[model samples]
Target chain A: MQRSPDDLTLSGDEQIAGEADRPFARSLPWLLLVGGLVGFAAAFTLTVEKIALLRDPDYVPTCSINPILSCGSVMRTPQAEVFGFPNPLIGVAAFAALAAIGAAMLAGARPRPWFWAGLQAGVTFGVVFVHWLIWQSLYVIGALCPYCMVVWVVTILLFWYVTLVNLGRTRAGRLLAEYHAVALTAWFLLIIGLITVRFWDYWSSLI
Target chain B: MAFKSPQNTTASGARAKIDAARAQDRRRAARKRNMTIVASLVAAFAVIVAVFLAVDPGSGPDGDTLAAGESRYVRSDSHRLTTAADGKVTLVEFLDFECEACRGMYPLVESLRKEYEGRVTFVVRYFPLPGHFNAERAARAVEAAAQQDKFEIMYQRMYQTQTEWGEKRTPADEYFRGLAQGLGMDMAAWQKAYEDPATLARVKKDVADGQALGVQGTPTFYLNGTLVQVQMQDDLKKAIDAALAG
Candidate 1:
């Protein structure tokens, strides 16, 4: 196995130590594949809905179940088209690329560092954009689209795992990698907490 | 083999080194396995707790199907035009101050407020329509006035003088600031609250609540959790009267 210069920085005696303790590293491609496909499906669904909305002005989307969960309301807003085109179009392309990359990686393709760096950048953008959308959905838009939420969850997981993989050469990174599941669980809990708190009235009334 | 040392010594030394490395690997793997098990158990326990709390089996809605929809009608912070001590009926109005339709309904709403008095709670919500040039600014001004115990005066002032600044392309912020001054509000404090992002957020919160209640236009009224269809001016009165009757 060809080791990079970063791998040599570890203790001399434990030359191959970091490589062996990487079961989490092995699961990266699986997360990418699954997350990417999930995100892709959501984005594609949103795109189709967007097209339908354009075709007929009064088209109520299938995902718009209630006022709080209304995609129809969100789709009509300018924020849905930040680039003068529907945001889901970007999602469709990016998620499709992610799925292809995951497939390549799963097929034992060892790409270069720059390639990983690029993927990291893409996911970083995706995660940041997803969070912005979350803020908009909860705060500004005052609504949530069910499909958009599916995309949010997958994007968060993909970003977390991709970041961990990119930094796996560092000691701190390896330590974090070991506690990956715990950290991920905590992150998800935090988001769930935010959603619960933000829509406390709506949620409480259901009981 | 290439070191040219005694073969047995070299072989034994290599074997010991391999054994030590394997032991370290086993220990590390075991620790990770244990940690993962503990973490998983904790996570599973948390999920179960959340599910239990969410279900709350015995205390669920009691067959009141409209409970969820009813919750959206009024929030604790919603402005009370009139509050009754034992009010069984709630009248929520999502309005844009600069909206002509809302202006048209203002007198009727005022009369209703007077007639209902202590029998119902008249709740006002800010829902500035995007098409209205000064609707949000007007709401912020009203909210800022509200902070100073002058909500009614400023609300009255907006409707009374809405024609002076309504539907112009230019922002009516200066006009609202002047109105704030005219209302005997402390200028420094009023200005501070007016410009505060939190004030805008507060107004937006109402707008958000309105949106969640499926309010797509100004002058939308909810009479006792039921959306009232106001085809004519009399419909609002009829709805309120019917709610009061029940």
Candidate 2:
């Protein structure tokens, strides 16, 4: 009655009940792989732009399309370097690690429960930090960076899935997981709707 | 070793049945939970839609209403930097050309114009302060430019070259005329318009209107006839956006 090394069932009771039958158990690896890679690329691009701006003070970022959607404005803000270093550096490291972990999981690495808990902690922190950044971009900074937005999307998706997977043992969590697609769509709609409404004037000018 | 004892085999079969029953019960529970979540989501969405339709913001009390007869926000003769097609949202800035703060705000306003281009109606009004020696002269110069369809050009030029002629005790009338020359305006017409008493009166009219509206400083902005207290550069843009949203 011994489980194999990679079985991620949280407890023996759930394992006995075959908790690994969930679809997320199979799909999450791929999600992490793709989400992590996309986030990594965005963060990497932002880091490059920040470095270029530092090298030449007059550098206009490629994402500086207009005043409202200007990366140049967002990058120049103190919040861009909240930890006394560029925030994208954290993104670069964290996303790369997530991608590596996803690759390992795809290769049948059933990490210890401690590892999953640690990852949950990391993603929770990422989600909170990203939301703070979103607020800063929308209200305080009054600008949006395209690459930063990409990171925001990936981070939110990753956080939701990871939390669902970790809380799989709970009945409410399982219920939420069943409606993940609906929940994700609603979540994204809320954010995108806010963006559209907040900058309606600037957006309408394009039309 | 194929040592299948009869009693042991029966116990394993019964355990298998129990496990299957537990799984089926779990799935039934999950299905009920799913239904509950979906039903609640639908109910929440319906409530949201109902609340949205119920709240008629136009009929609500507007805190930023202008007093009666304070139509000085935009006159027919007011110069527009950009006009919206719907004419729904108008942003008026009472600016003094020679004021240092107005010069500092120049780029921010220009960027806002670009961002809100056709979605906002941007109007300019002269509120030349008495402190600066060249304030009145600059307003008169710009007003004169308006006569020749060069109001926008002169308006831009004044801010672009504010440092050169601003804060000077002597008359920068010559400097403003130089800007007019740079713009290739007809010198005779420019001189006449610049010196016209009527042009000065036009500038004074705006100043008087701004005073009546409580515009005590340069770079005062009004979004849809309500004065905007802009403590930050983005406040002007934010106010216009809120008006447009409304």
Top of the candidates by DockQ: 2
- Each model's iRMS: 9.7, 14.0
What would the per-residue lDDT of candidate 2 be over residues B130-198, giving only the tens digit for each residue? Answer: 898889889989888888899999999999999999988877878899999999998888887776544
Candidate 1 structure, TM-score to reference = 0.53
Flag regions of model 1 displaced more than 4 Å.
A1-23, B1-246
Mind giving the per-residue lDDT tens digits that candidate 2 earns over A1-207? 322222234445545344356536667888899999999999999999999999976577999875566787789889999999999999999999999988998998776668888999999999999999998888776678999999999999999999898776466776677677668767876777677656644444333
For every candidate, give the share of true A-B contacts it also has: 0.01, 0.03
**What digit string (tens of lDDT, one per residue) describes model 1 on residues A1-207?**
433222345443353344333435677888888788999999999999999998876577999774467787788777899889999998999999999888897998766667878999999999999999988878876777899999899999999988887777577776666666667777776777777666554555455
- Give model 2's docking category: incorrect
| Interface DockQ of each model | 0.06, 0.17
The segments of candidate 2 whose C-alpha lies over 4 angstroms from its true place after superposition are: A1-19, B1-246
- The TM-scores of all predictions, comma-separated, are 0.53, 0.51
The top-ranked prediction according to lDDT is: 2
